[model samples]
Target: MKHLNIGLFGFGNVGRGLYDVLKRINSDNVTIKRICVRNIEKDRGIKAEFTDNPDDIFNDRDINLVVEVIDDAEAAYDIVKRALKSRIPVVSGNKKMLGHHILELIDLQEQYNTALLYDASACGSIPVIRNLEEYYDNDLLCSVKGILNGSSNFILSKIFNEKMGYKEALKLAQDLGFAESNPTLDIDGWDSLYKLIIITMHAFGVYVAPEQIFTYGISTMNDADIRFAEEKDRRIKLVAHVEKIDDRLIMCVIPQLISRNKYIYSVEDEFNGVVIKGLFYDKQFMFGRGAGGHPTGSAVLSDITACAYNYRYEYKKRNDSVLPRYTTEHTFRVYFRYKSAEQRNLLNFLKVREQYTSDEYNYIVGDVTIANLKAHQEELRTPDCFVAAYPFD
Candidate 1:
């Protein structure tokens, strides 16, 4: 086995967790040569070489691996690009970065003959990417749907099970390190959207840009929405779904009403659950802690270990002769709650199956196309509006 010298980026929670796990495992063949952080003097609480200069890691010929856990997507892209250009293997947990730049990065890796493994990028330690790359590469994959964000899931669990207010649950998650101080990415559903983009590439060999998918989060949810879900015997989960519909693929990330029979209905707290459906294999569920430091750090460690043996993702699905095309022409069953009839009219519902109005609440259950949702997504994010997608054929 070739000895590994790692250059780490971002000494935040996940980066620190990686450091601690490496120490605990005591892998004699691996060592962290340098850690790149924005603030070198921020008192990281452990002894290690730290640098504010990117070249400190890039210029060092001995640094054979780059593990990036940074929050800045652009900077992370630059670092990973430079490393792959230099023929160094990289393990990244930056889903936002990878989701945006994966097509180019894949080309670069092949051009320079290096590896970029990102099992840590999606669903923490569940190894979703690796499974899609290896296990389901030859299977007739029909759909992938799941809870992809643990911070949001944690908040939802608190709201549904503990009767906590959304803001209170969000604060608790942030205090426990499950969420960021400014959690627009998680709560507004961008985090899940980015993960879905990455999963789309692996599951169906297509690159769907983030903006193409319609995303609705739980930021606008309230007690009325919760009561409605309870009355229907359902739980609201932020679900990212990508399904191959004939020759085309349809994708979306939205707050969904999950019935009792679904795998993700009971996946509470910081845990994530993914249900992969294939033609022959049917549906397979993978569940684990989807956020925080240690679980993600373990995933990064697994990639680093694979690097020791010269393992890399083949991305076999991408090599298929006919790749699935992405489309937004499909429609979905939805439940929309708003403060006024004007807000309800904003969504171009194809047909209304149910409508309710009371002194305190007004909502409509109907069918709406993905295109209409994408066009009116910002309106749905308003304070008085909440929308949840219902399961429909």
Candidate 2:
């Protein structure tokens, strides 16, 4: 095997963890040539070498591999594209970059004849992409569903299990490093939405943008919703779901009331769980630590070791007879809790199943079109309101 030399980008939590893992593994055949960072002032505990310029990594011919784990989606894409065009293999954990520009990146990978793998993008420690490409390619997949966001799950665990307030739970999550300073992406469904997009592509060979999916979150979850979950014997989880309904592939990332019997109900507090349902096998469950440095580092290192041996995604679903169409016309059970009639009316329900009211909160369980549910996600995530999906069947 050929020795690997890597030019790594970002020396933050995941970056440091990757360095630590690689060092602990102590592979003599692989070495990190340089680590690039935006800030020079922030001191990362490890004594690895660092640089402020990204071009130094991309332009170097000796650096045969590029590992990117940065925040800026656009910059990360530029670095990956540039490295690929240079015929350097890349392993990235930037979900937003790939979610927004997968098709273009695939084109780059094809044109340059280089490898690009991001198994770390979706679930931290789960080999979702690898399994989809290898195991489920010809298995006649019916649906893929699971909890994808760790921060929201952590907050929800505190809120439902400990009866903690939403803000209080969120504060603890931030203090625990489970949440970012601006937790909009994690709390408002964009993080899981991005992951859902990536999952649909590898799971079904479809490339749909974030705007094309029905995305919702738990930003506005209140105590009344907790009581509702308690009464229903369910727990709230931020779920990413995609199912084939006729020719349409229904995809969404939303909070949902999972029954106690469901496998996902107990997957909480930064742990990710997914169920890939096939026509033959029924369902296969995958559970693991979804976030934190080591989990993400394990994913990154897995891809890196694969890259050392030159592995690339085959995207085998193209051989299937019928391709999938993205749609949200399918109806499902929806639960909405609001403080005012105006907020309740903002949602369009096909049929109202039940209703309950108190001085502070009004709860409604109803059937609603997926389109209408997604259309009102912003309003539902406003103050004193929450919206969640239920088992449609």
Candidate 3:
């Protein structure tokens, strides 16, 4: 039997989960030779060599693969770069690091001729990236949208179920361990945006700067809006969307009122769902648990299994092409939820076409052809309003 040595960076929740899975699948074929953690004294019942020094793994000629589950972007970036430079294949679950430094790493991967697989970066259990790479060919993917953030989704579900305010629901999420200590990224839509960047890079082969995307959170959502959506047979969800229009890519992450008829509305709590529309096939939906140590660890394990195969036998690089450059000038449909009739009329004056009024709030649906949404952004951003925009067909 052939044997492969593995080194791990970070022993956090996801890291320990990875260790358990690999050990469960313990075959004479592979062994975890070393594990790297910041504090070696922390109790992580694994029986592998733990160290604070990264050089230990980089210099170890026996270690053939490195699994990086570190959360810090800068530190993980430096570590991953060194691992790739050493010709050791890397499997990472760090979305922030990949979102910012993927192109640089891709360049280095080509230079060093090593694999840097990141199956757990965007969607924890969903194989969206690999599907896009291997399954579809000559298919024009017009749009990709989904409930991308589990933490925000959990908060929204609480607001819908318990009729609580955003703050209360957020506190609940944090207490439930669904949210991070610094929940800014998950609540502010930056986490979803990072996932969006990864998916967009995989599907469209483009590296879009995070600043270029429009992002909004559910912090502004109120009980009134939730009730109004319920009344309209709809639900409010934080959706991340990217679409191709002509030669441009239109992307946004915001809270939207999706009709009950839409499959995304059926997705509740920490569960995630993605919709992909193509020229040849009808809209494809992929839904599952989008987070957790075990689910995410399973994704990383899939990458490791593939790497193991590639290590033993040569396989063709799937979709080996330069990342495409896309121009984003696409028009989008906007949904404006306001507090009263007066604000609805104000939006009507701004050329909002579709209007709906309830006892609690009023909403206007319109087409945004350009970047002029900023002119009225302040008025629309009132504490009594909610705004969402999506690329129009």
Candidate 4:
């Protein structure tokens, strides 16, 4: 049997899970040679040589592969760049790093003749990234819409389960370990924004930053909003959407009231589901556990296994195509919500395409388009206003 030595970074929840899974598999073909962590004496209870120095892994000559489970962008970027420069293959589960630095990393991989694979960054165990790369070659992916964040989904579920408001539900989610110590990213929709960037890059060949797309959170959601949506036979979800419109790609992460008829509406707490509308195929839905130590670990292991096979075969490939630049100016029908009558008057000046009135709030569905939603973002940021857009059929 052939053996491969692996270096692990950050033995946190996902890292520990990787170690446990590897132990359960009991594979003689692979061994964790070393682990790079911040606090070596923190009692991780794992049987591996732990070090605070990343140079121990980066500078090591025998280590053939590096797996990064660390969630920091700058640190992980530096480590992975060094590993790639050293001609060692790398597998990362860090979406934030991959989201911003994929192009540069791909460039480095080509220059150094190494592989940098990230299968777990977007969807855990869904294989959405690889599936897009391999399976649907000739088909045009019309759009991708899904529940990408498990933390926000857990909060939404708690709101429904306990009949609590958004704040209370978020608190419950935090208490139950479903949320992080600082959940600003998850709650503010930036986490899903990272996933959206990865998906767009994979599916549409587009590279979008968090700043390029519109993002909203479920923080403004209330029990009344949930009940009203439910009464209307709709489900509330923090949906990450990317669609192609008139040769432009428009993406957003926002709280949406989706009809129960939609496949994404059925996806509940801590579970993720992605729907891809292909021109050649029927709407495809892939659903599974979005996040957890084990599920995410499984994804990272998948990447490692692929990297190992590549090393075994000595196969080298490069993605030379330039990432597509997207414009956020595409027009779509929007569902607008308002809290006060004052802000509602401002909509009359922009364009009054269509409107709906609910008990808790009013909706203005229109073909109005904003050139750069983020530049004039203050106009949409009023506490009284909430907006969601849908592609017009």
Task: Report the C-alpha lDDT of model 4 over 1-393, residue by residue, as the tens digit.
Answer: 235689999787678778888888998877899999877779876567999999898778788999998867789999899988898989888888887888788789879988888878787667888876666542366888899888898888767766656777677766654464468777778788888988877777767676777787766555445655676566678999887665667788877778757898778878889999888786999998777778888888888888877832111112434333477665555566776676665443245566667676776656545454455444656555766554333
Model 1, which residues run further than 4 Å from truth? none
Give the 10-residue window scoring lowest on summed lDDT in candidate 4. Answer: 311-320
Residue-level lDDT of model 1, residues 187-304, one tens digit each, is 9999999999998888877888888899888888888999999999999999999999888889999999999988899999999999999888899999999998899899899999
Candidate 4: residue 176 lDDT (0-100): 54
TM-score of 4: 0.87
Q: Write the per-residue lDDT of candidate 3 for residues 1-393, one digit (tens) a residue.
A: 235688889877678777777778776766778888888888776567899898888888899899898778789998889888888888887888888888888888888888888877787778777776666442377778998887889888877877667787788777765565468788778888889988887777667787667677776666666665677667788999887665566777777778877889888877789999888786999997777667777888888877877632111222535333454344556777787766665443345567787686777778654344433544655678777653332
What does each candidate score in C-alpha RMSD?
1.3, 1.6, 4.1, 3.5
Instruction: Give the winner by TM-score: 1 or 4.
Output: 1
- TM agreement with the true structure for every prediction: 0.97, 0.96, 0.85, 0.87
Best by lDDT: 1
Say what the RMSD of model 4 is.
3.5
- Compute the lDDT of residue 226 as modeled in candidate 3: 66
Q: Could you give candidate 2's per-residue lDDT for residues 97-196 as a string of tens digits? A: 8889888888888899999999998988899988887778544899999998888999888877787788887888777666644688788888888888
By TM-score, highest first, what's the ranking?
1, 2, 4, 3
lDDT of 2 at 276: 89
Q: What is the C-alpha lDDT of each candidate?
A: 0.90, 0.84, 0.75, 0.75
lDDT of 2 at 87: 89
Position 380, candidate 3: lDDT: 59
